[model samples]
Target: MSHGQQTDSERKPQVTVVVVTYQSRNTIGATLDSLRESCDAGLAVVVVDNASNDGTADFVAAHAPWATLVRGQGNIGFGRGCNRGFDLVATPYVLLLNPDAVIAADALTRLLTFMEQNPQVGICGPAVQEPSGELQPTGALPDPWKIMLRPILPGWAERDMRHVVPGERPQATDWVCGSIMLLRWKMIEEIGRFDPRFFLYFEETDLCRRARRAGWEIWTVGEAVAEHVNAASAKATGAHMMWDTIAEHYFRSRFYYLIKHFGWPAAVTAELGELLLMTVRAAGERLRGRSYKSLGLRLRSPILKLPVFPD
Candidate 1:
């Protein structure tokens, strides 16, 4: 590189990356390598291991001695683990990353530049793709109906359709993919921490929802890219069982959100409809020879609760 170019590169803003891992020994190294290539020497990388028996901590320390490893007290879940790492970060901006995700070489700088260009944006997320480079839905405007209808209805019907398309163009979105979200320190300070009530799912949407309500814009930096190994952490434990629990938690959290904002009647209505839909799907899947065990059924009893609100 030319001297002027090298000097300009050296003047880039410093970033602190916080990666939360749970049984990710197989994929963490690749993530670290990608981050190393994307980041400068001054970047502070914090890896919080959620008590993995796979020797994740030692492996990380030995491989990347510069990284600060925080061994989790237990599997405190994703949002909580990220919060733990966030406490240690004092940088102007922080990147919340998953161990199974890899950011492009220019992702950090591009995202940082985008945030710099748009002072109104408090949180920015990059375009996300699967390991195969297929575009993933990285940003969406959060709404109860939109979240519930995405699976039942076609893409055109949903209010947040931009996410379903693949591109490298910036756009305003309700929420960005938590797997690779970048937040300015000022926003994090003003909004407080992520709602730990969402042990696993919906935490990102909740935070982004709050950010939007607080008059901050959330943007998707389409030029920035990250390859995410979807559900890497959830799959580590037990895909079916873990996902079921996450779904239940999501439903409950949804109800909790409704109750807090819209009152109890709405919360009850939302909860009942969610439970009924879950039961029907579970029953259908079980009849397909998927096995009761695969459906989180230990002898045909339902794994979740289902009852009308008054009951």
Candidate 2:
């Protein structure tokens, strides 16, 4: 048989890695290079650039010609861009990777092997570390308890808090991070695709919740890993204010999620608590640094008009 043509038993199951880029010209190359080096699994790629004026599409075309590139007509936001990439890929498994993350050589292999062994696991995510090799709290179940505590605790602490014990059989979750997430074709068919209502944040959480309701299991693979240059796009794109705006959307989505899952009373209380907690937490962070005064002006500059508590 030809090298490309293997017996059914010998063939590796295919996985298409979908990366959505929005003005990620500098970092996308590194992300693609990592995939090339580490991905031995049957590999395909789809790069969807969301109306980036930074020549992100041209950069991908030149540097990663192997990838199928799609230049979006306008900024369609994160979920939509990813869905577009997902549509273009023709693999049994779809790996939704961020433009800032680089996969470990065995990451895809490990994730796929686990999913195959555990047929109930419709979606899986790998442990993500920072470029400096520290664990970046990437994936966790969105428990009501965790969400409440998140504002009080530090980022690392919030991330490390697993809602359920690890190594237990597959279970449902509110959502997992979009970074380095793996999804089976079956799950997509059953649960439906990501809801594009969210322009950026909480998009994954909303999708996972729907998947769980549909009886799909979300899995976290502790062994598989990736290095995520965390939040590079957010910083590079000068969307620091956009971060807060998206955060408001996240809280709004939480209210929406509560209404969808629970009811109105719960959503109302949840929204109030979230608003108060978020405001306090942002204040606390400013206090910890000596730049509270400077941070005030920055907070005021966003287009979304987030109210700053009188400091």
Candidate 3:
């Protein structure tokens, strides 16, 4: 098996997987289990635990003995955990997969094969789907000025499949969700790793943008698919309080992303827009005599089950 290591005579895996998990006890096993085919082909995998208190590390250690597990002192956050795992790898290609995501059969092989055949491509992502065979929403790269309209018209953000044609080959993409993305080692050596400052969201987008800026093509392979149980780690935390819920992290990360790429003034405007949108959404819900989440999911900020706070 490609366990991230091989003797001189043994064939090595061209790609390694890095999975960062936090409070993912409910879904980590399925994610690992889904890699059976890839693991058999010598695809070494590294699993990082960002201080999961739910015994997630123990489960990975005891259950997935083949995977190299990195336990954290505390919740180092997703980006940092992925960086830690990436530092330990030397494979030509690396995949950063979410603990809540499960790839379809041979999905890793296809993604790795695609990256190997297309050396110009630095980062590639699978077409995300739900376990029930539904196409999950993945967004195109955010436009600095255009994203401001997201608060008013949610669909202003670009769709993930905008560049894709159903029966065609892998197409160029601005960015893909961090849920299941493959990276080139050389790309990292050239452009650096995921921005550690981004605790969770937008870190992958930052990495993708950097790669694009470095003359590396970002792509999405429709043929390579994965089932993402979107935000299972965050849901596992069972945080309901506004400050404790993933919304806090999600919004804070969103703000940082806006400021880093755009500017502080733009980021502030976006935040205020979010507030206005949320208030409008609340008013609509009142008229409907029903409840809806605050500033609900968008192609730009597709958060699942945020539960409208104080629920």
Candidate 4:
């Protein structure tokens, strides 16, 4: 062997951080700045702008020339834009970061170290912190029952019933939120990437489900942390639209996820339950003289319009 040659163990694993942006001008700068602080020489960054006209692409080009920017893809939705960015990753690790989330200085390094030690872990996520420093519920398996009961039950009652809480121990989870995730390239080779059918929500859940089914572990490293300004870009986009487009998108994704995973019967029952719950809530709101525009809009979402089971 040559004197200067290095073995695979001696070589640091490279990572590519993929951020999908859409009108995320305000938050993208902070996110990039934090990434710069967290990343080492082995780290590369890619920003895929979904035809954002709010100077998001321009800002990335000017301020973050080190990052590879892919623009003019015309709002291809989160999952698809992420897939496009994934196509550009040449690293062993791919970190999918939300445009509004900022990793702590040692967060990326910690995640990488953990993954290196545990080859069986295919997907790992950091403990997400809200701007207030409170822990967000980033690590949880999808609970179809809780999701269904949420609309009908009081918040405190639901919390009591489910004992829903975040933990500080690094452990396996069903799925972590997509706000910040570190994925193994080998796992991608085996299970592929996020399902393009999911335009926004539930895509991460779907991906994690597939990975678990394929015998890879999904874990959340509680010690590694990131601060996320949740849904900043989505809120910005929704500002231009009426009738809570975000909620509608969520319902559509939920229906697709349920049908894809649990089959037609489960999806239909859940959809009907959701419709009934929303209708009751709307009536109660009206009786109290409160506006129920958002509830009404959700009740009429396209998910409800679709046949309970697709042909």
Against the true structure, whose TM-score is highest?
4
Candidate 1 on 57-141: residue-level lDDT in tens? 8899998887889987688877888899998887888998889888866777888899888989989888888855566674554
**TM-score of every model versus the real structure:** 0.78, 0.75, 0.80, 0.82
- How far off is residue 35 in model 2, in Å? 1.9
Please provide the root mean square deviation of candidate 2 (C-alpha atoms, Å): 6.3
> What Cα-based lDDT does every candidate model obtain?
0.72, 0.69, 0.75, 0.78
Best candidate (score: lDDT): 4
Candidate 3 weakest lDDT stretch, 10 residues: 302-311
Off by over 4 Å in 4: 1-13, 38-40, 153-167, 233-243, 280-297, 305-311
Name the lDDT value of residue 266 in candidate 1.
58
Instruction: Report the lDDT tens digits of candidate 3 across residue range 1-311.
Output: 56787686457677788999888888899999987677877778999998889999999999899999999888877788999998789788888888988885577778878988999999888778765455654446675455555545666554333533223478787777787888889999999988878776778888887888889998888887677876443446753323245555676677777888877778777666666676677688879998755445432343322112111
lDDT of 4: 0.78
Ranking by TM-score: 4, 3, 1, 2
Candidate 2: segments with Cα more than 4 A from true spot = 1-13, 37-41, 138-140, 143-160, 163-174, 233-249, 276-311
Residue 57 lDDT in candidate 1 = 86
